[model samples]
Target: MPLSFYGLLEASLLMLNGIAVLNRERFLKKVFSFSSLSHIKFQLIFTRFFSVPLIAINILVILFKLLVG
Candidate 1:
């Protein structure tokens, strides 16, 4: 895979992070068909935990690729 694809994936994850952090209600209402607000919030919180680490890992990968190249 190329660095560009990683960049795009990082961008996507950042966008998801923004949506999860900034516009919880609006995004959740339109995107997920959850029966309860609590459930949606829980999912958001859960996703938040993973997304941060993913972003960090992506940054590390990008750096590693640059170094290797």
Candidate 2:
């Protein structure tokens, strides 16, 4: 089995960012503050969480391929 260079880099950055967010006090506060908002806020929160990373990954992959190939 072969490992992709971009996949490894993406996974590593994601993990590192996830860990950093979890440990940061301001981030934790914002994450918890979402619960106090209305249902619309909750929906927006989840949508952003899933969509932002996906868009980021797509951009990173395109840039990586452009640079490498």
Could you say which candidate leads in lDDT?
1
Q: What is the C-alpha RMSD of each candidate to the true structure, in Å?
A: 4.4, 8.7
Q: Against the true structure, what is each candidate's TM-score?
A: 0.44, 0.36
Residues 6-55, model 1: lDDT tens digits = 67976787676576576656666677676797776778677868777877
Output the worst ten-in-a-row residue range by lDDT, candidate 2: 19-28
**lDDT of candidate 2 at residue 43, scale 0 to 100:** 54
TM-score of 1: 0.44
Q: In angstroms, give how far residue 66 of model 2 lies from its true place.
A: 0.9
Global CA lDDT of candidate 2, please?
0.64
